[model samples]
Target: MHPYDTIVSRDVDAFPLGEFLDYPRLMSVDWREEEPRMLSAFFTATGLPADGTTLEMDDRTSYYQLVRGSDRVDVPWGDEVSAQHSMLVALQRVFGASHSIRYLNHGCADTASFVVETNEDWRRLESANPHVRWFFTPIERLPDVFKSDIDELVRVGETYGGA
Candidate 1:
């Protein structure tokens, strides 16, 4: 199991292009083909040279790495509910909905991956967004190491109020 998982949009245009322009780190992923207009706007909003911001991956593996990296470090993408909730809040701020977001299980799922500290945190996240649907493999079915990490996160959340 990978340490982290990624959430991406099946339809790139589902994201709020205008709102995302303000997030420099989040906008660092290559989206030239996915949404050129939004990418252009992001560059303009951040004052980043358009040519400089355009990321060119040499292969599909590199592209996947970049996308996963961006998800791990950027907004609305994290292993834990808080991180995901933060993303949801950001989307709501832009008047966006939940139809396009998808969780990718294969990219990252290591022990160091993000996750809620406790079951309560997970419950809260679910309660907060009843309509949101998470698509990923079940925790019990994951490798022992990944399961242990998740268990540790739950314990941490129980003891420290979250990781």
Candidate 2:
């Protein structure tokens, strides 16, 4: 079945992995998606820090706070490193492995890719608000290596944040 055929609307509280991959609405997403906001949620899901401000990554569980005044990374389009790498691992686990993943920047604004990936709107949500920076691609082109690297990053990020 086509990747688009798999995604569907999902509850915001639940990790909509199964629904997203099963049925994608590509035309509607924001640029700076809700990534920063979801940091806590991601942490909570993996038995890490649930607080949004500080992060505990790696096995040692070092702590890192959300930097202030640091420019958020811009989301990437097809083939961009941001789209392929970054939070690939965590999302893969939340959603599943059969689906492909990628990120995209909003043409309307500049924002961190991290913020975008975690949002529900993904890409098109930004059009209305112009704040959406992150958007995930359909599950048609995910790479195996990308998924593995993401897993590693999560492990390390968790350690650094002290989750």
Which digits, one per residue and each the tens of the lDDT, describe model 1 over residues 54-125? 323435333211122133212322244232233322222221121111121322333122121123433554
The global Cα lDDT (0 to 1) of model 1 is 0.29
Q: Which stretches in model 1 have alpha-carbon errors above 4 Å?
A: 1-106, 109-112, 130-138, 143-163
Weakest ten-residue segment in model 1 by summed lDDT? 95-104
Compute the lDDT for candidate 2.
0.33
Best by lDDT: 2
- The models' CA-based lDDT, in order, is 0.29, 0.33
**Residue 124 accuracy (lDDT) in model 1:** 53
Cα-based TM-score, every candidate: 0.21, 0.23
Error of 1 at 150 (Å): 18
